[model samples]
Target: MTLKRYNMEKILKIITGLAGALFALIGLGWVIKPAAIAAEMGLPLLEGTALNTQIGDMGAFFFAGGVITLLGVLTGKRQWYYAAALLIGTAGVFRVLAFTVQGATLPIDKLIVEIVVLGILLASAKLTSVPQ
Candidate 1:
């Protein structure tokens, strides 16, 4: 690879790895301190089964997305990037839906993060490759 391309790969790997770790940590927070995480996310911790769903579903979403992203970076696996991209990109799509269809205020900050991360993952998937 050319020097510039190699440098770009290294940079992307570091960026994606940090993003993955951040997401996993957030997921852990959801499991360990659901109320605090919920408050930060502007969500309420509900009672009974709803609370269970909140912790379980949200935690799994973030944890899995993060783990898959890390795996992609570590293993240079394109498939893992595609998987993470789909997971995060779907969330982005739904955020738009919430704003347009559900009459919720635009979650612009979160959406920007999601789109940026999704772009990085997609670009990484295209640029990175598995070792033979």
Candidate 2:
């Protein structure tokens, strides 16, 4: 392999690893301290069943995405990356829908991060291949 290509791969791996780590930590926060994480996300954690759903559902969503992303990077499995991309990309689409149809404010910050992560996962999936 060329030196430049080798370096580029290294950089991409580093970026993807960081993203996975950050997401996992955020997921942990959701489970351990749902109130703070919910506040940060501009969400409420009301009492009773709603609070349970907020913590359980959101925690699983983020933790699964992070773990799958890490699996892709560690195992050199393109399918895992594709899975993460699909999950995150779908969330991005929802953000757009909320803004356009649900009368919610534009979530530019979250959208930007989602788009960048989606790009990274898709690119990584394309660049890597599974053994035949």
Candidate 3:
């Protein structure tokens, strides 16, 4: 590969790694203390057995994603980008579907952010993908 192409691939891996780390960080927050995070987001801080079961599920999901993606980047395995794409892109798609089903319950800004993340993730996946 050309030096420029190699550099681009490295940059892409780093970006993906960073994104995964942030995702894990947020998930950690959700895992560590869902009540505080939920309150900050103006969500109901439900307190009960059922709440406990549900609260950490998202945290675990993102945390696993982050760990996997970071490991892939560190190992120079470009394939993990596909996992990140699937996780993030699917989330964005589901968000849009929710809007369609629920009629725009989330704020426009939130939707925009999700869409942007999805776009960037997809572009990054495309940029970094190669036949290995």
Candidate 4:
């Protein structure tokens, strides 16, 4: 059987969709066991602090966004995908900013990975054409 070549747009959409699903899984894991995540990341366990609360909220948002992104991908809804991509990309930027503002250095590896994912999503958003 011959392999079919994919255009950049299709590849980007697949990448973004997969990344969104992965993010959703991560978020679900965090929601289920925030303490486990904290321990794994060497962060303090949730003790009802403002920072922890913020983290929780962020996690929830990410989870919801991821779900929406996945649905958009499945439905082939260009607008939904674009909106989700923008929202998640903006959130990723804010996360990096938050890390910097806390007198902590940004984790380059994490930031880079997030940036790549966002880039793929953005490219996919632009590449997708609405069905007539």
Candidate 5:
């Protein structure tokens, strides 16, 4: 039996769809403020500290990125998909940098997940034949 070569276009489509879903889920998590997430993650719900404010800002950015990615997927806009993916990827890199600078224990699991996602996005961008 021989395995068939995967179609790049099809893979990109799936990647875009999955990325959109993941972003939307992240947005929903931020909007909902579930107790389990808060307790497990030590995320404060209501307090206006510098850290909290920064988190809120990042949350807003993530929410918007999710929406944009969803729209790009639905509309078949390769450029939009690439743009959102790059933005999210860059943000993830910055997040890791910040964690390191703060002398904080890195969220290895989350960073790995984000790295995987970023790889998918980059591959999708290439497979879709979209100009970077």
Candidate 6:
């Protein structure tokens, strides 16, 4: 059998880096046009000053998380990777909390998306610790 070599750390590094990039892009979208983005995500785009305020607040949160994740990607630190995972996992946790409080009114689709994101972030963080 021919020998095959796999540089797992290198592959995971790239994958996590790309994940950070995606988060940054998504944050930018929400920041620039939260209404349109939220609508596309199947959330109602509310109106009024409160709507703008809420969207801005949430957009800033996303932007901060995304930037931090990108920094983790650049630094190649295991702590940074876990930090990113924590950021994402918190989102999923909050979604579940909202679902519990709001009952069936909570959107099913968004819950699904949050779960997927949490899974990816957790998996990435776990893989980052693989022995070299």
- Index of the highest-lDDT prediction: 1
Which ten contiguous residues of candidate 6 have the minimum total lDDT?
1-10
lDDT of each: 0.92, 0.87, 0.68, 0.69, 0.66, 0.66
TM-score order of candidates, top first: 1, 2, 3, 4, 6, 5
Q: Give the range of the ten consecutive residues with the poorest summed lDDT in model 1.
A: 123-132
TM per model? 0.95, 0.93, 0.76, 0.73, 0.71, 0.73
Residue range 1-132, candidate 6, lDDT tens digits: 112213555565576667677777667887687877787767677779877876776676666667766676566555666676777777777777777886635666766766665555555555554422
Per-prediction RMSD in angstroms? 1.3, 1.4, 2.6, 3.9, 4.1, 3.9
Each candidate: how many clashes?
0, 0, 0, 0, 0, 0
Off by over 4 Å in 6: 1-6, 104-109, 123-132
Worst 10 residues of 3 by lDDT: 123-132
Worst 10 residues of 2 by lDDT: 123-132
Model 3 lDDT per residue over 7-87, tens place: 787776677678778778767978787878677656786668767765767677678767766765665545665676677
Model 5, span 1-132: residue lDDT tens: 112224666766777677777767665666576444455555655555754664566566667777777776566656776777777788778778888787766777767867876777666655554343
| Model 4 misplacement above 4 A | 1-6, 40-42, 49-55, 99-102
Tell me the TM-score of model 6.
0.73
In the predicted model 3, the residue pairs found to clash are none
lDDT of 1: 0.92
Q: Can you give the lDDT of residue 10 in candidate 3?
A: 72
Query: Between 1 and 3, whose lDDT is larger?
Result: 1
Candidate 5: minimum summed lDDT over ten consecutive residues — where?
Answer: 1-10
Candidate 5 ranges with C-alpha deviation above 4 Å = 1-6, 40-42, 48-58, 129-132
